[model samples]
Target: TLSLFYCMVGVVLVTGGSGLVGNGIREALGKHETGEEYDWVFLSSSDCDLRDKQAAVELFERMQPKFVIHCAASVGGLFKNMKNKLTMYQDNMDINRNVLAACHHMKVQKLVSVLTTCIFPDSIEYPFESSQLHDGAPHPSNEGYAYAKRMLEVESRLYREQFGHNFVCAVPSNIYGKYDNFHLEDGHVVPCLIYQAYLAKKSGQTLKVLGSGAPLRQFVYSIDVGLLLIWMLFNYNDEEPLILTSNEEISIGDLAQLIVNAWGGNIEIQTFILPTAFNLKYNAVRFQQS
Candidate 1:
């Protein structure tokens, strides 16, 4: 009876439960159709500070979660990471390391870590096969963020290779949708443009986009990211990285227009900058959820 009790499926702990990815996954998992049983504690920013190792350990003990979806991150746009290099790198690294350590010791049924495609080098090889991860270097703007995430990839491999711990890793593409952050300084490209476009409409002015409009990017909706996270939890067991991209190629200029259109406006973009080699390698990930 005691052994069966330990094996019963129940609730799960989702760190960064407030983030776009975590929130999506929690909602999807929590909404399993009738008779499916699994409670979820959606921790807000107030529940605990994951940055503290003691707090992480304490949370793990209290929850005794069979599985942990570690989506908590000090993430942001390229500019923020580039500007606050030290803090960006150190904080993300520390939070991830502490959380994983706690998960390992607690014997979490499994752990799924989501990383960004930005972690790939500026000169990405076409098709962006999972193997190109360690090839060359990540874009400088995202280098710090990438470096911090690289640890999760490394640890997952080490844990599986040496200790046979269960873990899954994902490298998702540009994500955007409802509940996305729109903070002027820290938001990602889509949200930044969304906010900008809306504000420009209110102010009756054209929005200014930085860098060249030519660098291509892929945009995956929030729900898509959630589905992939859940899929990894159930279908994938390897430590190898998996990518999630819509592969809908669009220029920054076009993306800006889409945002403007999404905001119900036609705006002029008046900015000129040399096009850097930050090209996107079209990864085709479709939107999931029926």
Candidate 2:
């Protein structure tokens, strides 16, 4: 039996604390009213490599947190996901396993882990529900990462069923904000486009965007997701995972134009299989004139 004393006031540990979502949670908690109720320990990969079982156990023992918010995962953009599918799957699976196991062993009061909208099936109906997660296979482009995340949800439910643990999952759509990865080849759409557009302006070139600009996507700012997480921590206690999204869909072309407007530029759009290095000096001159 778990001791009542330890449960009364315990540390709150957030894994993957350096990334976008993790940083967002930290920012939100700093401004929250009840934030100071417990000691908050944010663990980045530098603090502890959670892929190792022993490291996870030792860190959990050292922190002795009664509550855990698991945000750690191997994440990447489209190119990286497609190129390194095996790495994505194995690394994330190990990390989720080690952390959730540690939390269970330590008898943590509650654990909130994050899931992404990409885990949904490729052929599912519109307006996604939690129940439709496993109805069909995910899109082929990122199936390895998607299936790995799906299993994490499965683990959460299994733990709840067998042990009656309060481990829960939070699913959010295409999160973007400050501290997001901005890699030219491996970053998400928003940051990648922003960085590319900046470069285009700087180098006197046209910004090269990949694929047809017709794909619709819904994006949630990391800070807003963070606030919702806080609310979930305090108010939500359930087996069903909560989907955190704004439900606003914008096409890639419109999104690109929005980015251009945000950056004070009007660039021409060209569709290509691979992003072409369009070194058009005229485009840069036009951008400058505008």
Candidate 3:
């Protein structure tokens, strides 16, 4: 029986188990001594299609998780977001809606959903605050994905108010680390640059970077975010979504130089200015550690 399987402790399920964030969570858990307290299950997309409500519910029933960390979403780089807005929006909305519904149906004790800083308004003030999430529209390049994520936060709050579910959301700035998507065109900035540098190093050619590389953005290590998430799972009980980010802000140009320097070999950096439509300047996220 489900209860029999977890006689000693309850199950804590993490979706997107094979992704970058999922691997971070796994690494964090490995460093801790929580194995005796909870059974951790990491699930990948191959396990089930979360966009399908029935499949999501069945997976929940099978896992019988007492807690859930929702990290699954249709995500990509700036160009991908711009080109495939509809697909991004639809897929994320479906995945989020189904997962939340299944979690509610199964009476999961607590659910922490992962969100990105990109969901904030495009023209908002620096030091993004959670309270200003919906004050204005997000950047046009990623509006579809941004709006979908905004709805996830909305649904989380609605579920909490109507059903008293302990559904929380974590908003993190640009996340980069091991196991990240390294696709040059479709991956996030850091991994994309890393991959580009690798290719440049192999070919001994100048590394080409997109845009002016002048956008200032905050980046947080996935492992650190993972550690904080585990802490939130046990201690945070409020409805307000928490912003998890580092204080340091680095321009893309400087970041690229850093990546090239880390490669050690002499590799020239060349910036390819993309259209204005592709330019996105992210301000540093302000987070006060408690």
Write down the TM-score of every candidate. Answer: 0.90, 0.90, 0.93
Tell me the deviation in Å of residue 41 in model 3: 0.3
Question: Which residue pairs collide, candidate 1?
Answer: 66-109, 245-285
Task: Name the regions of candidate 1 deviating beyond 4 angstroms.
Answer: 1-9, 30-36, 274-277, 285-290
lDDT of 1 by residue, 1-290 (tens): 53344346555677888888876775565543421355555665578888889998887777777777788888887668778877988888988888888988888778888877777766756876777778878777767878889877888788878878897788887888777789987998889988888888888887988887877887777766776777677667866788887766888899898777777767666556753437767555454454
What C-alpha lDDT, on a 0 to 100 scale, does residue 27 get in candidate 3? Answer: 93
Using TM-score as the measure, the top candidate is 3
Q: Write the per-residue lDDT of candidate 2 for residues 18-114, one digit (tens) a residue.
A: 9999999999886676557887778999999999999999989878888888999999888888889999999999999999999999999899999
lDDT of 3 by residue, 1-290 (tens): 77669644789999998998998999988665544389988999999999999999998988888999999998899889999999999999999999999999999999999998778887766665688889998888888899999999999999999999999999878899999999866899999988899899999999998878887777889987887778778878888888887777788889999999999959999988875332223443343344
What's the residue-level lDDT of 141 in candidate 2?
78
Candidate 2 clash figure, as a count: 0
Clash totals for all models, in order? 2, 0, 0
- lDDT (Cα atoms) of all candidates against the true structure: 0.76, 0.81, 0.85
| Candidate 2 Cα outliers beyond 4 Å, as residue runs | 1-9, 273-290
Can you give the lDDT of residue 151 in candidate 3? 98
